[model samples]
Target: MSKPNIIQLSEFDITQKIIESLSNVCTRAVLFSVKNESKDATQIAEELKISLSTVYKTLSNLEDLALAEVDKFIISPEGKKIKQYRSRIGKVEITVDNLEPSLNLYPNTDNPKSSL
Candidate 1:
């Protein structure tokens, strides 16, 4: 895998949002679960042992933050469309200097071993 790009953010509002999301246990779990492979909500929910509704909600939040994206869609046996989500972020680093916080976002790579 190629070296991933790092996105540094020092803006207070955006940085705060990212910090909050990363601080949440559920959000971190969901993001980590999809780091290597795309997975549907049901799969993520089962893997994390969280409720389906919570998975859906977390996916929405991730999308809003541009941390997760819909990699593809699948047609279930019942002819229902299911979204397969992947994490856009492979790793995150936070720094606090002079009472200011900043974030370093590492983009996810195609190689599973390269992902966090």
Candidate 2:
């Protein structure tokens, strides 16, 4: 039998990736709430407690990660669908089981018996 290989992420990007994962879930919820409506970048901004531009950036990041998608079109202030930016499903799977919390399942740091 062959042993398994492990790949680790850089300490810097690990945190960023975690933050991105959290942001991903949040964006999904926001999209689901406004599934049938056209939500502007400002709306997402407010909902996410971030700047309008932050919302745009976050959405762009989410889209790039394939965690969400947007449909851009013209819209009117009079409740008209002039140009709507519709959000849709573009989920990214995250397999957590194989990652953190299992790195050192059976440590031999103090295995006195093995010293025999």
Best candidate, lDDT: 1
TM-score of every candidate: 0.84, 0.43
Deviating ranges (above 4 Å) for candidate 2? 1-19, 23-36, 76-83, 90-95, 100-116
- TM-score for candidate 1: 0.84
Which candidate wins on TM-score?
1
lDDT of every model, 2 decimals: 0.81, 0.44
Model 1: residue 68 alpha-carbon error in angstroms: 0.2
What lDDT score goes with residue 54 in model 1? 97
Q: Write the per-residue lDDT of candidate 2 for residues 9-80, one digit (tens) a residue.
A: 322234345345445665555544344555667676676676766666656654443333445555666766
Q: Give candidate 1 regions above 4 Å deviation.
A: 1-13, 111-116
lDDT of 1 by residue, 1-116 (tens): 43222232333256788789889999999998998999999999999999999999999988777788788899999999999998888888989999898787787885343322
Worst 10 residues of 2 by lDDT: 107-116
